[model samples]
Every structure is written in structure tokens, then in C-alpha cells.
Target: MGQKGKKIFGISWNVFVLGLVSFLNDMSSEMINPVIPKYLTDVLRTGELLGGTLMGAIESLSSLFKVAFGYISDRFRNRKVFIFAGYALSTFAKGALAFTRYWWDFLSLRVLDRVGKGIRTAPRDALIAESSEEGKTGKSFGFHRMMDTLGAVAGPLAGIGLLYLMRGIEIERAYRYLFLATTIPGLLSLFLILFLLKEGGQEVRKKISGVSALKSRNLRLFLLVIAVGALGRYSYAFTLWKAGELGYSLEGEMAFYALFNLMYALSAYPIGVYSDRVGKKRLITVGFLISALASLAFAYARGPGTLVLAFLLYGVSIAIEDTAPRAYMADLAKDFEKGTVIGAYHTVFGIFVFPASVIAGWLWQSYSLTYSFLYAAVMNLLAFVMMFWIRDKN
Candidate 1:
């Protein structure tokens, strides 16, 4: 930890800076994210199944690179380079969305953006884990998530505001301009990563196999449970689509999306701090239960009021989902293998994102959107049941 960065709310400087980096990047990402599903459906006219496939492919396909990049970082003992490169790639790729006129163009650019995510996420998380003081791990991660999700909250609101400003323009063109505008924040974040964020003092570089972490029985079983839980962790696009299905305008859906992020940002730090005291697995188990309930609520939501409740619950559930698992993995990992373990967790979670979103889409197209939510609900419950078998490390 750098001496200069140690003063922000008592966390080390690296954690704080990384949090800001995530904040800016997320702001850039979410500006487009809330609109992408609707854009695909309305503007590109891809329909439910194809739109879902494209979204899923964007998420899952790039995720395949996470473990590889993570291990490479571990081998090099250099997190900053990878982190910097990842953000740069995503920034440029996201900016290219302005030129996309077809779904394939959108998919290509989105996949490139996610590939950047894959490169950065694990190493960045591992860096956060390394930056924290021992018992404050949860606090550090929670604070980071709070900052990151604050960006998520801001991004949609910003997008809505930008759209309002550009209302006179054709909708598709307005969306294009918004995508191009996201590059500003992305570049700012990249600048922070390159200049301000500092790595821990270098160690004597050593060659090690990152995948060795997978040999632990506990890690393997925990990963299995995580995979199950991920099956229910469908994309937020589904929720956005639901809002549209229920007759909300684009701005209304953006408001709802902002609301979801608000709850997530508000709860993340507290839940993380609490998990440090009580137990991570307990809260993680609770998160699964909440996810199940939220999914069921989404299935039966009648109007805006019910949708509000569902989104709030879903937000808290996601706060936990986003924070605890990584903290827990950090707790479980050896100092040398933190990047590997965390990367494995991300890889496993992401590996399922495709099937989960696709399944939701399939259910939506073949039966009803109601069944899609029901499937998520059931999968969450199964994950909750499986949680009982895994022991918490810290």
C-alpha cells in the first residue's frame, strides 16, 4: 500500500484508487447496459431469443479469458499492467459502439469490452484483497463495491439525462452518441489506473501454476455451489426487459434500473462489514434465499409497486452476491495464489452466465417470461440448499 493512498476512510490507497477506477468504468459501462437490451429488441429488432443469445455470448464468451489472464498476472507478479491494458481495451471498444448499426457489430464490440473486463476483474480483485488489512478485508471490498455501484446508479441517470437532452434526435442516433460519450469516463478511469494506482512492493518473481488452487477439495466444492448459484444470476437485462414488457418507457426503466443500483450501493458496505463479524457463508446463504424470493417476486409482479419491491430485494441480493463471494475467496486463497482463486471464482460464475441468460430467454420465448423468473427462483433455492454443505473459511 502506498503511503499517499492510506487516508481514504481508513482503507489503503490502492483499494480506494481501484474503487474509483471501477466507479468510472462502471459509469461508462452502465450508460450503455440499461439501453442495450431495449436497443437490441426495438432498434435492431433481434427479438427475445437472439437478443438473449447475443447478451449471453457477450458475457460468457469473454469470461473464458479471465482465468488465463489471472494466471498470467500471477506468473508475472504484475497486476497493474494487466489492469491498465484491460481498461484501455474496454474503453476503446465501448467507444466503438457509436459506429455499430447491426447486431453483429454490437456483439463484436460488446465481446471486446467484456474481454477487457475478463482481463482486469480477477487481477483487480486480487489486488484489492492484497491491499486490505487482515480483518478489514470485507470492509475494503464492501467500500469498493459501494463506490462501484454508485457509478452504476449514476450511469443510468446520466444516460437518461443525456437522452432527455437529445430527445429531438432519432432514438438510435441518440443511443450512439451516448455510447461515444461513455469513452470520457472510461478514459478518465484508465488515466487513474495508469498514473495513480500503485502496486504492492514487488516480490522475487517465481514461476507457479495458478490452477493449483483448484486442487483443494474445499475450493472445488465451493466452486460447484458457486456454479449452481450463478445459474440463477441472470443478467440485469432481463429485469430491464421485464420493465419494458410491463409498459414502462425507456426513462421509466432507467429509473427502475437506477433504483436497483441504489439499493445495491447502499447495502454493499454494511453487508460486507457485517459478514466480517458474523460469517461470509451465512450471509452468502441468505443472499441465495433472497435471490430466490426476488425471482419469485419478479415472476408475479403486477405493476410498478411490485416491481419496486422485487428490484429492491434483487438489489440487496446482488450486493451480497457481488461482495461476499470474492471476499470469501480471498479469505480462502493463499497469499501467492489469490489471483488464481479469485479468477477461478469469477470464471466459474461467468461460465454459467451464458446458460442462465439463455435459459431465461428460452423460457421467455417458449413459455412465458413468468417461467423465466420461476426458473431463476428454483435455481437459487437449489444453490441455497447446496450452501449448507460448504464451510466458511474466515
Candidate 2:
């Protein structure tokens, strides 16, 4: 292994520590994510329109702040502070969710939770990138993703146990217990962020001019590709909704989710290694194609077999897209301004998701669930075409 490779992959303690932090944090977040829609619609008696609206608002709004917080971290030459504060804020949000009674209160807590996500995401990602060796970026990112998904796996299982415990309990009461359970892990994540992960000094000393940064042909093209892909990427809540539409029991839906995550975890590292070997663009294009087919299958699926196929394909597509895109960004980013570039990428990408989620929700509410799936399929096709236009020579 080269020095960078050896440094990043061989014996990097920081990678392990950061991965643990994400594992715990994601466990905290995922515990809430899959069940939130049920809580809103079934427990609180909120309409689908309101549920979708809340989800769309939280996702888009959270993305908007990722850029700002990322830039702030870059400018101040600090990563740990933002990371620590973000986790602390998230802990508070989880605690606040336990107290929510009305729809607006739930929405408020959701926004606060996403705000914490926005504040932490870019900075945390940048820190991971900084800690990695140059050539081994994909592996580093894949490792982090593996840990993140491990938490994702744990979260729903935790939710299942809580649900079992509260089997005869009121729905609101169940949520209260779930929220309280999540708080312990969230607080633990904060402690890890504060003490375990080492902070690296900012890589870029001088900020590039805003217009110039935007004008970078490679970056702009890459951002376009990401935005196009994101338009097809609806929220995971929609997936759970789809499972319900197929007459899945709560346990069955959770099992499918667990399977999806299992596939996702297994695929992430291999795909990341593949991207590093072949090229990010090729893998990304394949990812879009796979996602397009999955969306189509989702739209047309009639039985459990087809639904299982769709979910499996969806998991594979996530593996390809998630690992490749960040590695692509890291490849294109100027060494000095990686944080700014990534912040810009995420901010712009996020701008697209707000509309995508709202549109998906509105389509599902107005027409049919099939319409939402079809919409995603069409968007993925367009994204596939856009991917071919960009040159990966940078």
C-alpha cells in the first residue's frame, strides 16, 4: 500500500472512532424515521397530506443548512465543535419528541431534528474525508457507511422491541418510550464526537471567490448529475408506505427494511472498492439505471415476490449511488476548498430533494401510489441521460 493508503486503511484509529460515532447517531435517527409516518397518521390522526408536508419540509430545510454549517466549519478551521454541537442539538430534539402532543408540536420536533442533521452532516463528512488517505477515499467512505448502516440496522430492531413492549400501550405512549430509548444512544454519540474523534485543521487557507467556485465546469456538471439523481430519490418513508400498500404487517415491513439494510451494508464496501478501481462515473451511471428499473418495478409490482425484488434492487442502487457520488465529489474537489465544494454540492443537491419529496407526496395523494413510483422512474431515466454528458477526466 502507498503511504496514503496505509495511513487511511491499515491502522487508522480515527476512522474506527468516527465510524462508531455514526453507528450510534444513525441508530438514534433511524429509530424515529421509519415509525414517524405511522405516528403522525395513525396515532395523531393527521392526514397523509400533512404527513408528507412535514417530511418534505424537514428534509429540504435540513439540507439548506448543511452548506452553511459546512462553510462555517471551514472558515473557523474547526470540525469538532460543529460536530459536537450538532449531536447535542439532536439529543435535545429526540428528547423533545417525547413531549409532542399536537401535529404542530411533532412538526416542530421534526424540523429541529433535521436542523441538527443539517448542522452536522457536511462537517462530519468533511472530517471523514480529511482523515482518509488520498487514493483510499472510497474505502474510507465505504467503511464509514458500513458503520452508519449498522446503526440503521440496530435502530429498527430497537423500535421493534419497544413496539413489543408497548403492544397494548397507547400509540403516543409507545412513541414516548421510543423517543426516550433513542436519547441514550444520542447522548452517547455526543460523548464520542467530543472525545474520540480527532479534529484536523482546515485544509484550505483561502476561500475561493463564490462565482469562481460555481463556475468550475467539472463541479457544476457533477452537481447537475447529483441533482438529477436526487429528483428520483424519494424519502424512505415512502418505501414503508409502499410496503403497507402491499398489505405487509408491521413486522413484515420491518423485516423487509432489515433485509434492505443488510444488502446495503454488504454492498457498500465492495461497490466502493469497485468504484475506486474502475471509475466513479461508470458506477454512477449503472446506479441510476438500476434505480430506474427498481422504481419501475415498484410501480408495477403486484405480489410479495416482486416487492422483494424491488427492495433488493433498491438496496443495490443505493450502494452504487451513495458511495460513488461522494468519492466523485472528493475526486473533483480542489484540495484547498474541499469543504466549500462539498457544502455547495450538498446544498444544491438538497434544493432538489425538497421539491422531489413534495411532488412525490402530492402525486401519491392526488393520483395513485403508482404515479409516485412512475415519477421517480422518469426522473431516474433523465438522470441517466445527464450522467453520460459529463466527462470524468478531471
Candidate 3:
């Protein structure tokens, strides 16, 4: 490896290992993602209104807990334990899906899985940042994202395969098979977390407490920007729903999802490297605009061509949002409580996502899917305006 590559690769091994853990976890998680909403509506005979509500509740509740767990991890200066516990929780949640016959049971397990995500996400990202050098933060995060996306790619593929294998079976049985198969990857992720990733070397520095960190003017503004951006962004479930409306088969929809992940994975590193050179704030602004455009396309699209373009733009937007915001958090955070700060940032951002999703779901049901997309597009426009207020020196 050359100097930059060598440096990135050196600390990046931890990221790589963590990526493997994510890969396994995503393989488990994605199996559920494209299927669960359908299962709720089609198999369990739950209505779309209830399904959307459940989705919003699970996502928001999970995000709320991430803030709490992230603070706990930072105060204790031990990230590994939280990570391990989080993975274990997810493993259990995946298994629990097999037994879920009632809507509440399914929703409860979804919340549990999200709880694990909320706990692990901040500390895990903090670890990636701490393991890397300042200039390489974007690259490090990008690499981690790539690994996460790799799992995203694999998970749905596995789901597609399982669906094919059980093609003749009843829909509920097919979901059960997917749930059981997903557990294998989930448990494997936990095992990797235990054996591969290291913990407990870095000392917690003396700094402002979590509440005080939230008081920082720059961080507060950044959180506001992310919240606005998130409002414009709806869940990917909407994208799949759009594809279905366009007459794409489930397999075809999965292929499009795979295509999106492929682009997202390929773009993450390059975008991260570019952001490091250009400025994270600038990249974030650009990302929001791209997402705004994508939402517009989705809202107005009347045919397959427009849907394809929208999904492509959606993939690129994700590349920017996922990598740049993370790099920005690392830049703004104090060394001692990096995890806590990032957690707070995500927590605040996530708190808004719940309302955004609920509104999006409601709009989709009551008004039109196009209106939901328009709502998200408007949020992105507002986020674009807010970018002018952000100072990027950090």
C-alpha cells in the first residue's frame, strides 16, 4: 500500500473487522427489511396504516435509546461491551421474529432489534473515528460504510434466495424461513464482535458532560441541519412500494435494491475522500440538494425510467449523507466524549425522523404517495437553506 492507503489500511483493520460484523448483522437485518412491511400488510392482514405506524414507532423508539446507550458507553469509556450487548440483543430479536403471529409481537421485536442498533451505532462509529487519523476520518468512515453496504447487498440477496427456495410455500412460511436463516448471520455477527474487535485502551478525558456538549452552538446547528435533512428523507420502504406500483416483480425490486447498494458501496469511499479535501459541510449541502432532486423525481415519476433515475439519485444521496455527516461529527466532537457527542447528534436527528416518517406514512395513506415524496423534497430544500449557517472549520 502507498502512504495514504497504508495509513488508512493500518487503522482500517479494526474498521474492516467491524465492517464484517456489520456485514453479518446487515445480512440478518436486510433479510427482514424488504420483507417485513409486506409481511405485516399481506401475510398478517394488517392494514397499510397500521404497518406505517408500526414502522415509525419502531424506528423512533430505537433512535431514542441510541442516545442513552451512547452516553452510557462514553461515561464508562468502554465501547466493546455495549457493542457486544447490542449484537446479542439483535440476535435474540431476529430469532423472536419466528414466533411473532400478532402485530404487537412483531412490532415489539422490531423495537428490540432497533434498540440494539441504537445502542451500538454511536459507540461503533466513535471507535472507527478514534482508531483513525484526523485527515483519514472520512476514508475510515467510508470504509466502514462500504462494509456495512456489502452486508446490505448480501442480506437482500440472501432474502431473494430464500424466497425462491420457498416459492411454492405459504407466505408466512417463507417469512419464517427468512427469519430463521437471518438468525445464522445475526449470531455470526455477535461472535465476530466478541472475538475480533478490541476494546478499553483509550482513556476518557475530562470534558463537558453530555448535556453540556449538546449546548455547543456548532453542534446544535449541525443537528438542526441533519434534522431538516432527515425530514425530507423517507424510509427506503417507500422506494420499494413505488417499484411495486410501477409493476416491478418482487425479484425485480430486489434487483433494483441491489443496484442501489452496489452504487452506494462503490461511491462511499470516493465521496468520503472528496469530502475530506473539499469540506464536509460543502459535501453535505450538495448531498441534501441531490436528495431533494431525487425526492422530486420520485414524487413526479410516472414511469419506470423516472423511478430508475430516482433510485439512482437516491443511492448517491445516501452515499453523501452516510459518510459526510459522520465525518462532520468526528470533526466537531471533543476527544473525551466523542461517542457521547455523536450519540446525542444521532439521537436528536433520529427524534425528528420518527415524526417525519409518521407524517410520510400518513401522507402516503391519506393523501398520495406523491404527496409524501413532496413533503420529503420540501424538507431537503429547507435543509439546503440551513447549510448556509454551518461553519465548516472544525
Candidate 4:
């Protein structure tokens, strides 16, 4: 059996280190995430549509830099530096979030936060890929993703808990305190990376353009399909927005949001492990179909019970989508420039996010919520149809 099969108390060393980093970092990000929509509308007075649009815009804009950082990491043949810098930058950005009093400040700081993610994501995934034992890629990446989702699970719970603790304080001021406290875990993640993460000796491969890295016909067509699907896959902030739309109290909505992350965390590793046996392409097609159903569920759900099912479906969709796609990409890309290929994928997908958000916001404001969600369902269904043509033998 591979080292991937031999986990030391359920996690291999390198995957454990990276997973710890993600856990702390996600705890920090998720704390504020559950409350951000309400924060923008209630505190900053940005209103609903603009709040959703801004969230998407910042994510898309910040993610645009991932391709460059990815190429830079490949050119240097050093992943650790970018990883450290990305975490460090985000830590500082998290610290700065509390001082913001305006919408632009929110946008600016949020984008700065994503800057760290943009810089780190591709290189970090490359590290996970490099660290994996042969024939164990699915388990390795899946384990890392599981760790990441674990952080997502804890972050929202911590956020809501903190809010409960500061119950007597003004709500806006309490939000600031939450932002300030998030820095500790964020800093810890960066601190641990300095010790826990290390890179292997460099191989002297010719540097390639990020775009040129997608020489495989499968990768190109795969990316095109993903980008098209991304048009309906707006940010998760919309999920919270939808919860609030359903008349859940802020606290109730936060809990519901946390439930989704919890499900995502639980399912990520198992799905990854299974994909290793079944082949990733078949699982990915199934996930797209699930997402289509989830979208429809979110659209029509009238009560908390129905919404719970919707959120769980969303969680299952996310877990499968997030894990299987990476495994498939790892399967397809050349070892020499996998970081660049992943970066290109993140970049194009992120670029599409801006317009998707805009379209969603427009539809949301101009039309009914039912239409807004059904539109997403329709796009996902189209992707489900297109997934059949992926040319995979599975």
C-alpha cells in the first residue's frame, strides 16, 4: 500500500501539515462569511443586490492574480514562498478588516484577503500533488480538501458563538471584535507553515506559459465546460442571502450555513477515496446532476425543513465537485507544470464569476427569487448534458 494508505492516526505528514494550515485559515474566513451579507446591508447599507455583486466581484478580481502567481511559483520552482506570502498577506488583511467603515473599504479589504488565496491556491495544490505517492493522488488531494472543509465547518460555528458571547454589545461593534479575533488563528496558520511545510529539490524543466500548459485536448475541453458551468455558480454569499430571504433569523441562517460546511467536510475525503476506485469522470457527472437538483431545491424550498435538504444537497454537490475535479485535473495535467494548469483553471473560472454574479444580481433584483434560482438550475442541467461528451472512458 502507498503512504497515502498508511495514515499516521488518519493523516499522512505532509497532508496533515497543509490541512492544519487550511483549518486555521478557514476558521478565520468562515467566521465572517456567515454574517457578511447582513453586514453589508445592515451596517454598510449597501443593499441586497449590490452586496451580492460586490462579494462576487471581489472574489473574481482577486482570483485573477492566481495565474500569475502560479507561473511565478513554477518559474522559481519554489512553492513554499508563495504559500507563505499568501497566508501572510491574508493574515494582515484580516486584521485590517475591522477598520473599514465604507462599502469600498469592504471591497478593498475583501479583495486583499482573496489576494492571499489567489497567490497560494495553485502552488499549494501543486505541493499536495507533488507530495502524493504514486497511484494515490485522489487520497492525497482529498485529504487536503477534507482538512480545508473542516476549517469551513468550524469557522461559522466560531463566528456565531462569538456573536452570542458579545450579546450585550452593539452588533456592528461586535462584528469588529470578531474580525479582530480572527487574526489569531490566521496568524497561527502562517506561523505553522514556516515550520511544517517544506519543498523538494527542484527539477530543471523548461518554463511554460500558463496558457500553454493546457496542451491536452481533454484539459482544454474540460476547462471550457467548467467555465460555461461557472456562469451560474455564483459565490456562497448568495447562499446566506437566500437563507435570509427565507425569513430565517440571522442566527438561524448562520447555523444553517454552518450545516452545509459540515456536510461538505464529512463527505470530501470519502468521495475522494472512492473516486480512486471508480474513476473521477463518472462521479463528477453525477455531482453536476446533483447540483442541478440542489439548485431547484433552493429555488422552491418554502420552509426550514425543505431548506435543510437543499443545503445538504448543496453540500454534497460541493464536496463531490471540489474533490473529483481536482483529482481529474491531476490525472490530466503533465507533472512538470501542473501548478500553471491549475492556476489557469482558477483564473478563467474566476473571471467568469464576475459576470455570473452580475447576471444573478440583475435577475434577483429585476425578477423573482424563483426565476433567479431556476436560471442557475437550467445552467447546471446544461452542464450535466455537456458532461456526457467529456470523452472519458469511465
Q: Write candidate 4's Cα lDDT for 264-338 as tens digits.
A: 988889898898889888888888788888889888999888899989999999898888877777666666777
lDDT of 2 by residue, 57-151 (tens): 77777778888988787777777888888788888888788888888888888788878878887777777677776776777778878788888
Quick one: best TM-score, which candidate? 1
- How many clashing residue pairs appear in each of the predictions shown? 1, 0, 0, 0
Candidate 1 per-residue lDDT, tens place, 243-347, comes to: 988999999999999999999999999998998998888889999999999999999998888899999999999999999988988888777777888898989
Off by over 4 Å in 3: 1-11, 203-213
Q: Could you tell me which 10 consecutive residues in candidate 3 have the lowest summed lDDT?
A: 1-10
- lDDT winner among the candidates? 1
User: What is candidate 3's lDDT per residue for 190-221, written digit by digit as tens?
Assistant: 88888877763444435434345566787788
Supply the TM-score for candidate 2: 0.93
Lowest lDDT 10-residue stretch of candidate 2: 2-11
lDDT on C-alpha atoms for all candidate structures = 0.88, 0.79, 0.81, 0.81
User: Model 3 lDDT vs. the true structure?
Assistant: 0.81
**After superposition, candidate 4 runs with Cα above 4 Å error:** 1-7, 201-213
Candidate with better TM-score, 3 vs 4: 4
Give me the displacement of residue 102 in model 4, in angstroms: 0.8
* Reference-based TM-score of each model: 0.96, 0.93, 0.94, 0.94
Assess the local accuracy of residue 72 in candidate 1 as a C-alpha lDDT between 0 and 100: 81
